[model samples]
Target: MAPSEKDARREARRRAAHRRVEPDAAPAGETAIRSDPIRVTADLTPELYRHLGRHASRAAEEMDLPRVPSVDLVRAWIRVSDDPLVWDKVIKELRRAKQ
Candidate 1:
């Protein structure tokens, strides 16, 4: 089959898998990782939470992934910002946010 045809088949399978689970619930056999007691947490404002959700949804659609969890995106950002330039930008943002 052509690549497009293969991708279509894969997408169809993903949709089918999604349909088998409840809309707001994790799929069967999936344990909730957040239930652990020793987890680090950050409090986000409602606006920021919604923004993250929108970004994650757009990223998932653009990448043709099943879902893009916001935590994963934040982790990627942290991983990529190891350079001094990135640190400077972060400090600048923090200073701006303080005003």
Candidate 2:
């Protein structure tokens, strides 16, 4: 098949085995891991003390950020956490937070 036809078929397959690669390489000194938005899952212990809504409220109040749902904060954290610089910030802030 032609190059374009192959790519089209791969895209339309809607299956992991038929994935097509697009050249969106990260720049220098950056990791290409998780370069695109993806849906990941976690089975949090719901009975645990802390939860997203409460944390989100506290973060908004302490950090003077907009009052959005805590899920947004968690999602944004996941997106940036792979970066070392941002990870450092996470470490700093988390260390400062109450354990």
Candidate with best TM-score: 1
Off by over 4 Å in 2: 1-11, 14-38, 47-51, 62-66, 85-99
TM-scores of all candidate predictions against the true structure: 0.54, 0.37
Deviation in Å, model 2, residue 17 alpha carbon: 4.9
| Residue 29's lDDT in candidate 2 | 28
- Give one digit per residue, the lDDT tens place, for model 2 in 10-61: 6654443323343564443243233457777666677532577678888789
Best by lDDT: 1
Q: What does candidate 1 score on TM?
A: 0.54
Candidate 1 structure lDDT:
0.81
Error of model 1, residue 37, in angstroms: 11
Model 1, 1-38: lDDT tens per residue? 89999898778667656765756756644522233345
